[model samples]
Target chain A: MSRPAGKSKLVRGAQGDWEVVIGMEIHAQVTSKAKLFSGASTEFGGAPNSQVSLVDAAMPGMLPVINAHCVAQAVRTGLGLKAKVNKKSVFDRKNYFYPDLPQGYQISQYQAPVVGEGKVLVDLPDGEIEVGIERLHLEQDAGKSLHEQHPTMSLVDLNRAGVALMEIVSKPDLRSAEEAKAYVTKLRTILRYLGTSDADMEKGNLRADVNVSVRKPGAPLNTRCEIKNVNSIRFIGQAIESEARRQIAILEDGGKIEQETRLFDPAKGETRSMRTKEEAHDYRYFPDPDLLPLELDDAFIASIAASLPELPDEKKARFVKEYGLSAYDAGVLVAERETADYFEQAAKGRDAKAAANFVINELFGRLNKAGIGIERSPVAAEQVGTILALVAEGTISGKIAKDLFEIVWEEGGDPRAIVEGRGLRQVTDTGALEQVIDEIVAKNPDKTAQAKAKPAVLGWFVGQVMRATAGKANPQVVNELLKKKLGV
Target chain B: MSVDAATVRRIAHLARIAVEEGEVEKLKGELNAILGFVEQLKEVNVEGVEPMTSVTPMQLKMRADKVTDGGDAAAVLANAPQTEEGFFLVPKVVE
Candidate 1:
């Protein structure tokens, strides 16, 4: 068995090619101030039990009341995914035994999820492809268990318990690991735009359980392995690559794949099958008796849709049309909402093409090297706009702009103020430039004679004038002055 | 539609209840009797009505997104059988 036919990401086997089917269930923490069913704070990095309420601890006779903001966040996420929002959704109890989960059952949606089918347009290296979203349901996260704290006892932190999570399930539409990565990227961008979730993978807000399976070309999807503990996007791709190959090896050896969950070990770069459960999965799902069914009206959903921010796809298209940016550059700029906002702020009332170059090639490049996010940049977006305006207005040359950017990045001062204080303005004066050209021509007569024959040699004279003035002379003015003086 | 001995034991096992071999038959009878009473609800003709998620005639009451409670770790972990440093301590169950 190999991968799928899409983008020709087929896995080669000993006998023939196989297709790998990939789906994802992303668990994104809902950006809320309180837990789903309690008034406990949802702030990260609080004391272990400081943020947990009695309802979260599953105290006796404690009833669960839903948090309105969490439900709105879930709706906002579904709307951003361009999915159908079910007017009515029920919360069911998923019964299981776990020390981390104080309640024997988890309050989750099983049959009827809040969000229905949706589609995400993933921008792959080859081309753009659409991945179908199966469903997105709201659930509570379990507590964190630390076993290294004690030798024979595990310490459980309930701070994260009862925190709301939107499990966005994707269809088996990704054929390659690249597609998987792009899908997550696009989804995260949309979530950030909606302000529904922080979508930070390192913070455990955005986690994924990737389902990988391999089959023959055009054949039915075979047994798939659900890989959990994938905390980062890089690990998501590696898990898929190794899991696909593992399935291929098994099928080639005439062994049928077992449908079970596995854990990805990034340190080892392989997937390990989880220990078999002592008992079978019997989640006796039923409606939660503590809470009533969630019923949403048309106006509520319409209001959310109306207030929804512009997503990555629409922003990228606008950047291409309005800013005259290349599709690839637009994709990169619009991948993050903050970056896109910065681009607009920098490009406004300036040379947009030059702004794109400055932002993508210069500002972003420097930011990447500094290992800081745009929000933490020393140079503000308005300051960048000032530097670009200086270049466009001939106040400073492009070379001087680099120096100005470096000064601003290091010292955190106004770009215009730094340029003026440092006297980095361009020398467009024709008289001074002519005098400088005369000195260069008088010094290099032999070279001047050669330049008379080949006007292409005028670039050499322009360089000499720029250097004499410490790279402050305007090249266009110097070029014309040199031609008239050299008679070439 | 009916509960078998195996089904009864499976339910008991999932609920983390220890049932003897002889108790399986007795539990099956009890489960069947309870299911019989619930099965009679199927005799009523109630089409087009949505499944009742709650007996009360009201939508789910949702609280505002505010930190109105919590911050007393002592009270939160008071009932725990074993706790240390404001964390509930349980037998190590590593996965």
Candidate 2:
């Protein structure tokens, strides 16, 4: 149940059923301060060329040196993915021409990469699926090219040029859009947990290239089209669906699928061909003459391995085992690093399930409604813990806890102090609750007689009593007192 | 192992080199000679040797992850063919 499987069924098309196969090549910017080869800053949104170094600009006679921190970050990420760290890997030059690539070629790993085969356990709604990783490599990123900024000219920004990027490639194990989405999502979560990359799709720190191909069910893989640079997970899903349908249409129409790179037009919900003037698809990769093969010893691998943090998979398991939360709740909470930390802080010394419920159902729901992330959540974890404490100790009824939460969300205050200052505590005193219940029972004599006949009618009286008490009456006490008064 | 006339033109085009129609035949002969000479080096029988990417045995040097070199837009773009507002301007290239 927790293993990787292809869940995508064959799509029934005009002629027959077709299967969609997808693989991903994710380019994640390394969470580092400088470029891969120079001291240039890797900060986002800097002034154009401000972060560019002479080496990054590719001035004549300039050389590139590896950034040790970036290498360590990549190795850490590979270890987190359970990938094998290659003892020696060579840097190769992928030659091409583009205005953004002033160097006329990009430094990439072709013949050998730093990391080898591994598997990432992706959690889907149905179950956990493992996505096979092909390899992870280190490369330098090209600069940004803005084409629409000028009518007849383009502008280039080299701030991102020469920045370190981990090209994590996945085996063609995906079978559906949902699986692709889950794979990218789980990969992003793992990256965030490892602290290798910020993994923010919106910030362009993480991008994915999706490969989509369709064939008759269970047939050998067919011609696959590469969709370049789909940024968001939703777009990845859309791209796969559109590309699969297009290929199926082509195959049904007896037209061969062209193996070429295409782009996903998100606004139009379709993919268009990137028709470029080129002679065969040739990148002419060769070993970079300037850099030597990277060699990592056992000590180096062990050091990075020791520094590894508990990733999402282990964290989810620990959450379920330690906090006794539902597997679903643990999965949800541990999907992101901060949410898990938030849950741990809020669940400390409290009813763990109760805390999990409120954190997931109440707090997360509110955060989603407010369109905010847990990092920016206004409600503090400690406040949540305090609220749960209040509910657990019967200091406030469950209904009053919501009001308390809203009050804290809208305006900050101490939960205990707010309960005291606003007189919002549950009416747990037996005399007061009984008095309220007696009044309710007296007002509804017919209903009270009915309650005597059917004990279930006691619920109506409880609701009436709670409504009369402004939802602050302890429901447990109210139920007990009402049952006694009804003599049922 | 050998270069043809068409292959010479294609190689010249890929390298963005401007070669004349009359020069293609000469360039092809020269390229084939170079390949033939390189092929002769393959005759060496020594097998227990290591492939080297560099002339030295020093490991690849790595620098600290620090912002110690940038922040000079003018110097960075000093040799650009065109510039505006700290960005390099070129003929529009769209994908």
Candidate 1, residue A118: how far the Cα is off, in Å? 1.4
Residue-by-residue lDDT tens digits, candidate 2, A192-276: 9899999999989999999999877667789899999999999999999999999999999989988889999999999989865
Q: What is the Cα-based lDDT of residue A329 in candidate 1?
A: 93
What is model 1's interface RMSD? 1.1
DockQ of each: 0.82, 0.83
CA lDDT of each candidate?
Answer: 0.90, 0.90
Report the Cα interface RMSD of each model, rounded to 1 decimal. Answer: 1.1, 0.9
- Cα TM-score per model: 0.94, 0.96
Considering only chain B, report the TM-score of each candidate against the true chain B.
0.82, 0.86
